[model samples]
Target: MTRRTVRIAMNGVTGRMGYRQHLVRSILAIREQGGLALGGGEVLWPEPVLVGRREHALREIAERHGLTEVATDLDAVLADDSIDIYFDAQVTSAREEALKKAVAAGKHIYTEKPTATDLAGALDLARLATSAGIKHGVVQDKLFLPGLLKLKRLIDGGFFGEILSVRGEFGYWVFEGDWQEAQRPSWNYRSEDGGGIVVDMFPHWEYVLHELFGRVTTVSAHVSTHVPRRWDEQGKPYDATADDSAYGIFQLDGGAVAQINSSWSVRVNRDELVEFQVDGTHGSAVAGLRNCRVQHRSATPKPVWNPDLPVTESFRDQWQQVPDNAEFDNGFKAQWELFLRHIALDEPYHWDLLAGARGVQLAELGLRSHAEGRRLDVPELSL
Candidate 1:
């Protein structure tokens, strides 16, 4: 098959996910394979050109990657007739506006999640992309993860018949930026800049629910800013406007319910970092960020819950390990390749703007539920 090279204009090329994951990891994966296979012709490979804020930083990135073309002006790249796609890894606050502009310029868009801080804005962006007849996608990378994929397979196979509910325990303590220069950027703490676990992570939960259980119809949640203040790399204290943690209940279409506890404050003590436990009438499965285990009804034991009595083991001992299939790379990279393939092969990648909006809507609904102390209906934003 003849390879059709797709030129990609990568915005925010110097940011953390940009230089390391989006550029180095994603583009490198495509390049390493020479080209990705698709239904029609090959997606060829990405020709990623860098665009960012600082010229010096951009130059360093270009030199490090052995690329020469760099642009400080986004408009110039958007205006360039040669570029076929616009890739955005910019700060959350900047993502919506930049993507709107890119869509207007007639370029396909592949951007990071939390597409917008507000539901209305996100919906409008979705409409704009649809009207323009452009390919659009968001980073729902967790779905592509090996562990999560295995869990999805089990659910599809009806390994968990009549799934009762799922409990997700996710998080790890992050270092203060001042002393250790935190791994995540400092801007993530500011609400004005589109920071919050409810907004950032509910998209992940939404997809997981949509995949493992069913679509989420409503959400009731409470959010908190556990650490109200944090110091930046420069040793200057900044008020944290976004919630550092969120506790929410997802009401699925069926009677099934899911409880999600997402936080940045918790310390990891178990063998698995992020664990999702699903219990059903037939069996139960426990999946972590790195592994998954399942136990059938045959192994179920009769036990009585007694507060005074120290109960024996509740879980079965004959739990089987779920085999890992595909080699999982960085989550961001997995989604990147999928998006490019979708564009190249006309493959169905429904995890686009509308799918992304479900997540934003969840956050917006979660915020309203938190503020009003009530359950909020999750509105549908069409693709």
Candidate 2:
């Protein structure tokens, strides 16, 4: 078998999601598995060149991971002719400029979304990448999760039988820096730093709804900063200018309504930190990060509401678990493998920069819907 190496310039490895999911779980895990087999006796391997503003951090990660290449200069990294891909997991504010440079350098682009801080910027990246004829993709990792995958299976198999609505609850309490160090970066609470639950999570919701159910046609939202003041990384108090919680109602193309609540202030009571329940005429299913449970119309229980009587029905116990018929991989890794295949083998990939732009558009409209106190239509984006 012929082995082909694709050199990737990976930026923002110093951050949590970049380091943990993209670098370690996805790229490194693929390497450990002896690279990805592209049929016809060809194997595609990843060679990562770590890029960041901090030379010390880059060098530290390189050494720890037994990697050789580390560069603080992005321009120099981009100039390397051997580099096949440029991947970014940086903050929203910084992503557009970096991705633009990568496109100029003729590198295949793969990055975390919003794609940019706003819809215009996201569309610009899409246009640039499309013009450059580069194989570009966004990190829509949730689509590959075991739970969502199972849910997709159900959708494809007609288990839903005319889906009616979707209800999603996603959140967990993030520690304030004073008593305990904040679980998320301090920038997440500051609007000036491009921090907010709306911008952060609405993108995920957009793709999930568009892919699994239907394209979101309209959105109504109410956003708030439930925790106005929080301590920073240094244990200093700062006013949180961004909304920490957001309640959104999305109208899908097929007359299905999706209501999702995203919050950093709420405590988790569900089986997973995030879960979505989809109801249909025939059945209903609830899916989380790793598990999915369904209650068909035949098995669904009916209960009478009475204040005078104690509840006797075990509602949770009635749902049947979705079996994993095949081995499941880490969601991030699975998407990474598909992206790699798209780059090396010319496999069709749908989640391009345009899809990412759609996500950004949803977020922008969601925030606008909250501010204007009305539902907004989601126009189809074209580049």
Candidate 3:
């Protein structure tokens, strides 16, 4: 079998995720590693052309990554007969239109999550990609995290026995631009531009929950904009229209329950940068960003609860880090490699546009839930 190299034109190459994840992590890092491997020993490399708005910024990025092709126009890149894939890491608001154009030009697409801010638009993109016979993928990188991967192994191996529920604690204090002289991108704090934690992250949890446990049948959520305003990179004050915190609960397909708390306002006290704990009939396992600790039936604790009772520990120890079987790649890079494999080798990749649409559905429902002051049923949009 002849191995084919995938020529890529990366849109939004100047943005944060575009530069870091799609460009540096996926392109340069993959080059550093020779090639990106899919599950069945398939590998793909990017023959990349960087596209962005600013000439100097694009040139700097291209030079840093040793890429020679850099462009300031989308139409020029998309029209290029040589490119095989059009990668998008643009803001959520820009994805739908950009993806539509890419598909129309008959290029495969690998895009960042929340493929579209609206569920209907997301679904349309999926359908359009299918009709065009163009492969499309959305990044769902959390599934490849070492800690989350270990938790998944426990679930699949029946170490957790009959699964009960899962709790997810995600996020930390994003530096406010005022006092810390640091801030997230200006667009992230604005609602009109499709910036909100609910829209940005719920899709992540939606897929993670579906992959680790089961598909979420319904979701009930309350989202809040705790910090009403923030300063931009230039120290200009701006009203924050996006939610800074989100509290959500889901009922899985098989009656299992899960809850997720995502916020940018909290301080990190837990060792886990991201914590996911699954409780089962026979045992329980808690996973942090760096470790997964399991408490089997043999180590079950017997306790009496009292408000003033001092804490006693059993089955408590520093969770050992899951050993690496492969080279460590950041979340986005891992998924990018997988998508490239799916393109190059025709491998099975579950991170499709439909999966991306599911995430948008969850976020849209979460917003509706907050607005109506009631739980919104997760609706399946018919194609």
The candidate maximizing lDDT is 2
TM-score of each: 0.94, 0.99, 0.93
Candidate 3 Cα errors over 4 Å, as ranges: 1-3, 36-43, 312-328
Candidates 1 and 2, the one with greater TM-score:
2
Instruction: List ranges where model 2 is wrong by over 4 Å.
Output: none
The candidate, 1 or 2, that scores higher on lDDT is: 2
Clashing pairs in 1: none
- Best TM-score among the predictions, by candidate number: 2
Model 2 agreement with the true structure over 1-383: per-residue lDDT tens digits: 89999999999999999999999999999999999999999999999999999999999999999999999899999998999999999988899999999999999999998899999999999999999999999999999999999999999999989999999999999987888889999999999988999999999999999999999999999999999999997889999999999999999998999999999999999999999999999999999999999999998877888899987767899999999988999999999999999999899999999999999999999999999999999999898
lDDT of 1: 0.84
Candidate 3 worst ten-residue window by lDDT: 314-323
lDDT of 3 by residue, 183-210 (tens): 4687888999999999999999999988
| TM-score of candidate 2 relative to the true fold | 0.99
Provide the RMSD of all predictions against the true structure, rounded to 1 decimal: 2.1, 0.8, 2.4
Candidate 2 at residue 120, lDDT?
A: 91
TM-score of 3: 0.93
State the local distance difference test value for candidate 2: 0.95
Give the whole-model CA lDDT for all candidates, comma-separated.
Answer: 0.84, 0.95, 0.83
